[model samples]
Structures are given as C-alpha cells and as structure tokens.
Target: MDDLQFLDIFRGKLIKLTLKTSSYVGVVQRINSNKTVLLADVVYVEKGIKVPGLKLFFGHEIVNVEFPGKTNSGDRETLGYKLEDHLLVEEFQPYRKSIRLDDDEDDEVVINFEVIDEFHGKFGSAVMHIKKQRLIGVGADAVEAFQQGRLCWLQIATKNKVYLFDILVLGAQAFKNGLSMILENKHILKVIHDCRVISACLLAQFGVRLTNVFDTQVADVMCFYSETGGFLPDRVSTLQEVVSLHLNVPSSQLSSLKMKSQLTKEERELWYKRPCPLPLLKVMALSVIHLLPLRLVLLDTLMTDYMDLVDSYLSSSYNEPGEVEHINMELASSQAVPFFAAGTMQWRHTPRLDLG
Candidate 1:
C-alpha cells in the first residue's frame, strides 16, 4: 500500500512516526494534500516528554509507521518492519500521564467554604478579607438564569477560602458593599475561565466591569500556541475540560460530580428559587475551586516556555474599550467629510486619495 494511503488510515488515531534522525508519537490531526502529516499533542518518543504544538512531517521523511496492537503477515511484508517488535510500550506511558498534575491515589481536593448570604457583621468582614487578597478565583452560577433576566450567585476563591455571595438575596447591595471594587481593581489579579458571559452579566446587570483578568481559557490557548506555534480556534475548552486536562483531576471523581450536577430544563428553574440546596451550592463551589491552582500551573508553563507572552496573558481584561466605540468613531469621521461636485475631477480624486 502507498505510504500516504497507510497514513490516511490512521488519521485521528495515536501512532508513532519513525524518522531518519528521531522518532515522535502523536495523534494524527490531518494529512495535507501535499502528503505532509500533521500531528497534535506530539511527544518525543525517546525523551518521553510532550512537544507543545502540532507537528508536521513530510511523507518521504518517514522511515516507518508504528501503531499499537498485533502485526499481521500483510503489514510485515508491505512495511518490512514488525509492528509488535517496535511497539512504544515504555515510551508512551509518560505521554499518557504528562498533563496529570497529581498521582491517581492523591485525587482529594479540599475547599474552605464561606457562605455570605446576609448583610451582617460577618458579611463586612468577609468583604474586607476578600478585598485584602491579591489574587482570587472568580466564578458565577445561575448564568443561564441571568441570561433569561433572573439573578445569579457569585463565588470568589482565595488561597484559604471560597466565598459564596448570594446575589439573589443581597441584590445590588452586595456590589455596593465591596464586590464591585474587588472586580474593578486593576492591581488584584482575577483568575476566571471564559469571562465573556460572566463579564457581560456583571457589567449589564450590576454595572461592574472586570479588570486585571487572567482568563484561564485564553491562557490555555496561548500556552498551546506557545508550545506548538499554532492555534485551534474551534477547540475552545470548557471549565471542566480545562480542569481535567491541566489539574489531572481523576476521571472517576469528575464523572461522579458530573452525574450529581447534571440538571434538566425543569431542574434549571431551581436557580431562581430561594434558599438553594446544600448539594447544589456545593456544585456551584466546584466552579472556582480549582481556578487558582489551574492559573498557577498554566502561568508556570507560560513563564518557562514562552516568557514574552506572559504579559499578554496577565493583561487580558474584559473592561477594555469595545469594538463598538471604534466603529462609531469611524462613522463620525466619515460623516464629517464634505462631498465634492460629481462633475469635477476632485470628486473621483477624493475617493481614490482616501483609498490610497
């Protein structure tokens, strides 16, 4: 069989590529029309370390292709290499567990919860404590409710504690107390995942703008770009997916939490209900619990591998001047220009000059 044909068979599957100088292992992303193979999540076979970005390999440069499982007579005759003999057994283990932050047995995550529903003396202290912190993980619940013109809860996680603020109960008064300042402060770093929706909700509903944001989702994309020198725009990851990838949260634990937290359309109506259940609140707490640690891990990778992009990551803010302002300014400038007579050369020349 043709080499290109063989490669096409394994597109989207994990395989090892034997080159003249070195070998690499990765999942087949695409095979270009020119016979260049693109691989994602590539790993150096000998070193057992992941190579950051997508890797492209020319068809002629490949000496042999090795995939898992038994080798048949036809494969041995056509390839002249025993697939079973050169299988990447020991070399592939590290790649499988490279992104795991912890061991399988050490899957416990502890969160210190502080529920602030009432406007009391403790509420003032909680606000003060949060304001004093330099870094906090911000997460919001009932976002679906907020989108549908209902209220939501905001959770803030520091190194020692997680504050569950009842936006439904305190309403705008919560922001007046201290939450607004904490979000708008430029000095304090807010670690949030995919801040677009939450930021919009905060701005539209409460008039609070998010500043000095270290968006974990954006950071993850940047890290991928730094490692592989490319971007996959369609591959925007969710918070749960990001946590499982970077933090190595066990699959069993994630599955259990997911099972417990799965809600139907009818169940989603509970977001507007008063006095939310303990189990549901715990589900809300999970949103921000791993954000701080996740940010730290991603930042360390960015600082070490791509120091230049670190500033870009830290400076991500939803409060920046929007595109609408720029568009309006352009419209105003265009409208200010005087129109010339249609018969004159100046009329044609003006449009050409503007184009130039």
Candidate 2:
C-alpha cells in the first residue's frame, strides 16, 4: 500500500509527529484531504512535553510519524500519556576573545563544497591541503576528521550531513556505562538491540566509559509509563510505539523506515548467485538516513522534557573560583553496571557475551 493511504486510517487515532521546527504527540482529530488540511489535538511535545492549547499540524511540516500499540489489530485505542517540555535556564554574558589563525594576516582563503565519501580518495590531496591550511568545511565528517587529531575516518559511527558549527557539546566529564543510565532498565536495551543499530554502536564506539549519553527511549518510557501506571513486564514499549506516543509519528511510516529485509532463505540463496540488487542497497541506505532525523526529534524531546532532571545530575562544585564544575559525579557513578566491551580479543567472535 502507498504509505500515504495510512493517513486515512490514522484519522481519529493518536500519533507522535516531528514537525519541521518542533515535535508533537497528538490525535488526528481532523483530516480534510479536499482542503489539504490536518488538525491534531496537541497533548504532548516530543510526545512527552505537555503544553497548552490545540495547534495546527500541517502534513508538509510532518517529517516523521509513529503509531503506538496495535490499533490496527484492535488491541488498544488512545496514545497513553500526557507530558511536558524543557524548563528555562538562567542566562549569562561573557567577553569573547579572538585568536589569529595564522601569522600572515593577508593569507586568507574560503571554500564551500559538498563531497560524498565515495570520492574521498580522489580529493585526498586537496583535503590534506585544506587541513594543513586549517580551512573548515561544513558538510558531515569534515569536523570529525579535524578532531581525533587526524583528518580521516576513525572507529566512530558515521555521522551524516552534520555541520560542525551546529554541534552541541553536552559536557566534558566522563561516565562509565552512561548509556545504561538513560536506558533505565534491561528491557529497553533488548528492544533497541532487537530493531535499532543504536545500542550496538554505543557499545562499539564508547564501550563502558562515555560522555553525554542520552537515550530518547528512556525519556519516552519515563513520561508515558509514569502517567499510564508505570512499566509492566508485558507492556514494554518499542521504538515505534515511543516515537508514535511522543513524536506524533505513525507506526506504518516507522515500519517503512526500518526496512526489514524480507528476503527469505530461498530468495537470499538466489540473490547470492548474482549481483546484489541496487534497490536493496538504497533501502539499506534509507534505513540509516531515516534514523538521523529521528535522533534529532528524540533529542529535542529529551532535552525539553527533562532539563531539570538532567541538571540535577550535574555537580554543584566549581573547577576554579569562577568556573563551576558541570560534571555529574553521582550520575556517572550510578551507571557503573556492566556494558558491552567490543574490541576484546577473546570476545571478538562471541556474539552473545561481551558485557564487561
């Protein structure tokens, strides 16, 4: 079925959707295809952040949608919870300092271009010259290359179309198994591991010690489960359900984004005898492409709904008389549970046991 057709079925149902600028969790109160209009009962921000007033949610503004539970299967009705957005923080102003890039004030150059990684080797010398000149590029892996003391791919997860200037540094202080702290419980880990590549990446990239680990699933569960009688053994929420409940997205679209390889054993065997399908490669790429926007939506929800909760975890001490220590020692120490160890020689081939 064309995915757009699901919108007709979604009418009167609850959804979490990501608008161009913000996120919302609401019910599809009205959908007039003739008028090209959509109206939703906005109950949640990030599907967890509660705010006042009903708002207009345009179909074009919707970047993604999720449907929670099994409404199609007649299993449940309604989206489940009410919620909140971020609390405000105090403002401060400081005199900024300037530093010269190089000794020669007359030597200045600026370049703007986008390069796909497929052509990375072709532009190797040009990129090296730019790095030597300390020139910055805006697309994707450029800034990451500048970091880690090398202008090349590292053991880090691939970041797509990221602007280095737009990056937000959460903090400097490190935490052990910090991913687990935001993950909350074991069931959440299993759910993400089952469908999403996030858990595996976290373990592979950071191992136990990590900085600024925030899992959106944790925020969603806290918001939804708290209002709907908390977590029960049989009622664990999936990523789709959480996104649907919090982001105002629909499940049908989420399923499409997942793009589960439906190839059977016979089909797989047949495909192995020939060149892989181009559509299959595109489908795989789409899976990763869809995840980036979803991550942003989840991050927006987490930061908005739990700013205070996050602040409470930070340290109250000062690094110096004027500089405050923002590291959260208590929070960091709390996450000292076993986390996956990816590079250990003994466990390299072991699929099940990597926790250390």
Q: In model 1, which regions exceed 4 Å deviation?
A: 1-110, 143-145, 256-265, 307-356
* RMSD to native, candidate 2: 23.9
Q: State the C-alpha lDDT per candidate.
A: 0.63, 0.33
Global CA lDDT computed for model 1: 0.63
Give lDDT tens digits, candidate 2, residues 1-356. 66467547766666667767776665565565643335343534532333333466666677887765434232112433211111111100000012122232532232121211222232343333332322111111111212221111111112221111101111111112122232323222111212223333334444422223334445444344333332312233444455445444545555633333343434433222111133432323323322333344545554553576555444333225456655543332323221224422111111211111
RMSD of each: 26.7, 23.9
Angstrom error of the Cα, residue 224, model 2: value is: 2.9
Clashes of each: 1, 21
Highest lDDT model number:
1
Model 1, span 1-356: residue lDDT tens: 98668757767666679999988877778887786889864656654344555889999999998774232223222322111111121221122334333232432244457567667646898888988888889988663544555456798977646788867666898898889999999989999987776787888888999999999987776565545533323355566666667666654445524543465656666655443555556666667767877887888777864454444444443335342122121222332222323212111111101100
